[model samples]
Target: MTSSPLSPYLRDFERLADLETSVHSLLSSHGQEATFHHVKAVAQKAAELAERFSGNVEEVSAAAWLHDISAIIPNRERIAVAQGLRLEVLPEEADFPMIIHQKLSAALAEEAFGVTSQAVLSAISCHTTLKANASKSDHIVFVADKIAWDQAGTPPYLPDLLVALEASIEAASLVYLDYLWEMRARLKVLHPWAKAAREALRADVSKLQTDKSLRF
Candidate 1:
């Protein structure tokens, strides 16, 4: 019997879509429809934004689909799960361990689905807090997570973020961090990663501005 063979691109796309479907089904079972919707939106948003930046769309999309897989974990028990797995926790995460979903998602992605691409795994890992040394794919998933929210009503931060995005992803990320700082962070409770990201982004923007000034 002759079987039609899938091209590499089609094969990869199908793989990613399949993974997304499984995650969706699992989320539905757990009543995490909002999480499913958010991750789905993030996948679409990553694919869209990747066109402008020449990023790996498939990688970003796959990472987005799996990034929040840990939402299956109950909020109250996330710390215990992480502890059982012997994962290290930051002070803030120890206090509010719900944020440990990032690490859990990465671990689950590999253990459950055999996803071995470091780029996709890295993107999945950092999509939540966005480590200071995050890659381009990481930033895409991170930004998409915030911009392509699940709930009703437009997020206020999206407008200014769109304005900054018109310039560049770096600019948009700065706008995002600025909004985060003004909103919950200023009132207190900024993640250390966010604080570090803000500092690094500010430095990058300042250097760009300086370079522009020198050219003028």
Candidate 2:
């Protein structure tokens, strides 16, 4: 028996799914199973969250799934690789190479899967660093990466994040940033991206408050 032709949406999803499968094959054996589960969770969360707002669901889904592709590289060497990629590495980023995975993942998404959408690439690239002026797609992936998956034990900020999700993507991101800040503060090791996210989200959210203040 022959299978029926896939609908456009199904075809698209399947094509991306095939790429995902290839990515899985390329993934190193270490922690592959757990990483696969984490990526799927992040993709689902990114898609759902993007749908709640006017984000690019496709971009969010793809980026979220592929955001950690470079994790195949050992975490310890991330800083060395990251430094080699850039001429001037920031002190904080040089100190914490794990953040380099975002850029490496974005590059891998492009080279491996031919991802061209800046929205998608930007989401992948800054998912960790969360550069200033992040688009909705970027913000959605960033928030989903945190709220959907956690390497640490049960995330203590889930309740706060859920509340923020009801409020807005900007709000959810702020909550996540706050969670990161608390974690880093306790560890006494702050990644540059965390600082960038905090400042960017604060600026983004403050605008709403400023507008409300003027209206009242």
Candidate 3:
């Protein structure tokens, strides 16, 4: 029987959704439904933000669904497996794999599901943690993750975060750096990749300050 042709992105989304559901089910078995819900909600918000920014809808949606697949595995297991595979994980990430499940999710999407597009992989990979060379899609995902609607216990003026994000890329990047810095401090730990992301933003902040000084 001749089958209807689906776009490559549509096919990827379907496969990714199924994979995400399976991962969620595994997490539910471990009584981590709250974590699953939080991650899923972040992914959904990220996709919506991506659409608003003229991003590829299917790609961002699929990235949202698959960005935390590795959380299905234990944190210790993730560290061991990544180490055994020589994946060059940062120490902070290895210690807190739960916080950076997107890296493993990207690998699984590529190796298991044949999602070889670097853009999609990168969006998935950097959804939780911004990287120095992050693409537009990466920034979209990162912002979406931070602004998830389901976020509870948020301050009253939280919508200002989105306003700041809309103002300029530099403003948005500063907010992201602030988040990373706060998170690192709260956890009392650091990861090499996280440090690099922080440094990249510090450099941007410096340039912004320099430009202001020149104008003055």
Error of 2 at 95 (Å): 1.2
lDDT of 3 by residue, 78-130 (tens): 76666654566776675667655667777766654677778889888877667
Give the alpha carbon lDDT tens digit for every residue of 87-179 in model 2: 245676566666667887776676557789888998998887576778999889988888767586877888888898888888888887787
Q: Can you tell me which runs of candidate 3 are displaced by over 4 Å? A: 1-32, 149-152, 155-160, 182-185, 205-216
State the C-alpha lDDT per candidate: 0.78, 0.74, 0.65
TM-score leader: 1
Lowest lDDT sum, 10 consecutive residues, model 2, at 4-13
Q: What TM-scores do the predictions have?
A: 0.86, 0.83, 0.72
Better of 1 and 3 by TM-score: 1
Candidate 1 residue-wise lDDT, 1-216, digit = tens: 432111111122222347778887767766789889888888889999888888889999889988988877777777777776677778878866766788878776776567899999988877767777667888888888879876689988899999988888767777878887888734435678877888898888899889999999
Candidate 1 lands at a TM-score of 0.86
Clashing pairs for model 2 are none
Using lDDT as the measure, which candidate wins? 1
lDDT, model 2: 0.74
Error of 3 at 173 (Å): 3.8
Cα error, residue 87 of model 3, in Å, equals: 1.0
